[model samples]
Target: MSIHLVTGAGSGIGAAVARRLLERGDELWLLARDAGRAKALAAGFPGARTLVGDLAEPSRLSWALGHQAPPDRLDSLLHIAGVVELGDIGDLTPKVWNETLAVNLVGPAELTRLFLPQLRLSRGHVVFVNSGAGLDAHAQWGPYAASKHGLKALADALRREEHPGGLRVTSVFPGRTATPMQAKVHQQEGKRYDAERWIAPESVATTVLTAIDLPQDAEITDLTVRPGR
Candidate 1:
């Protein structure tokens, strides 16, 4: 069974991906923000392991992971945890921008760095769960979109650098998924939250699984998922 480390596994797309992996008997490692969240995730996933590290504080992830026992043979690293705050660029503060970049971009970069040895050994794949806003920024999505756009850059550069080392990197840009983040987005936008109108988290999970499960002959560099309804 291949082992995988996943972030943002508490809910929505992350949770869906975690569940599907577990159901298939893949070894799972979950990254939680704190001790309490780690404990809760352990309970929720039964056999899965948990590591405590806050993505909001990217600099400390090294110290945090140094204190814990991470998986030594990871087949995949799933960067799925993210945070979003909607506001006009003028109203967004430095704190907001820093926190968004820390969680969405820098943290993933650091995590990938720390896990590179194990991943390289296994020829693992790295999947970034990005947003469509990474490609097109809307009025109130300044910071979040900026972070995601940086994520796309990270994925592209990593893919080029690691290609000879047998590493696969894929960016999945999903649009308007029915997630808790989406609900909050709608609330911030002063609109009704309708789950049915958005893409299902499970649908995105399927895309992720397909990318990793593809034969070693080729790689899926980027994927975009949108709501059909």
Candidate 2:
């Protein structure tokens, strides 16, 4: 069975992806921000392993992961954890921009760098669960969009640089999914929240799995998932 280290496995697309991986007998590692969250994820995913690393503080990630015992054979590293606080560019503060970039972009970059040896050893995939904002920025999405846009660049550069080594990199841009994050976005937008109106987290999970499961002879560099209905 392939092994994977997943971030944001507590809920939404990350949870869906973790569940699917566990159901299929893959060795799964869930990255939790704290001991309490790690315990919770361990309880939620019975056979899966848990690692403590706070993505919000990217600078401390190396030290944190160093203390934890991560998987030795990693087939993929799934970057799905993210936070958002919607505000117009003019109204947003430096703290907002810093925190958003720290969690969404810098954290993922550091985590990937730390795991590069293992990933290179296995020719593994690195999947970034980015948002449509990565492609197009809109009002009140400055910080989040900027971070995702940087993520796209990260994935692109990594793919090109690692191509000779057979490492795969994919950026999955999912449109408003029915996630707690999406609900919060709606709240920030002062709009009605309807789970049915957005893409299901499971659908995005499927897209992620498909990208990772693709044959070694081919690669899906980028994928976009939008709501069907």
Each prediction's TM-score versus the true structure: 0.99, 0.99
TM-score (C-alpha, index-matched) for candidate 1: 0.99
Query: Candidate 2 on 6-113: residue-level lDDT in tens?
Result: 999999999999999999999999999999999999999999999999998989999998887777878999999999999988899999999999999999999999
Poorly placed runs, candidate 2 (over 4 Å)? none
What C-alpha lDDT, on a 0 to 100 scale, does residue 201 get in candidate 2? 95
Which 10-residue window of candidate 2 scores lowest in summed lDDT? Answer: 65-74
lDDT of 1: 0.96
| lDDT of predicted model 2 | 0.95
Poorest 10 consecutive residues of model 1 by lDDT? 67-76
Residue pairs with colliding backbones in model 2 are none
In the range 107-151, model 1's lDDT, one tens digit per residue, is: 999999999999999999999999999999989899999999999
RMSD of 1: 0.5
Clash counts per candidate, in order, are 0, 0
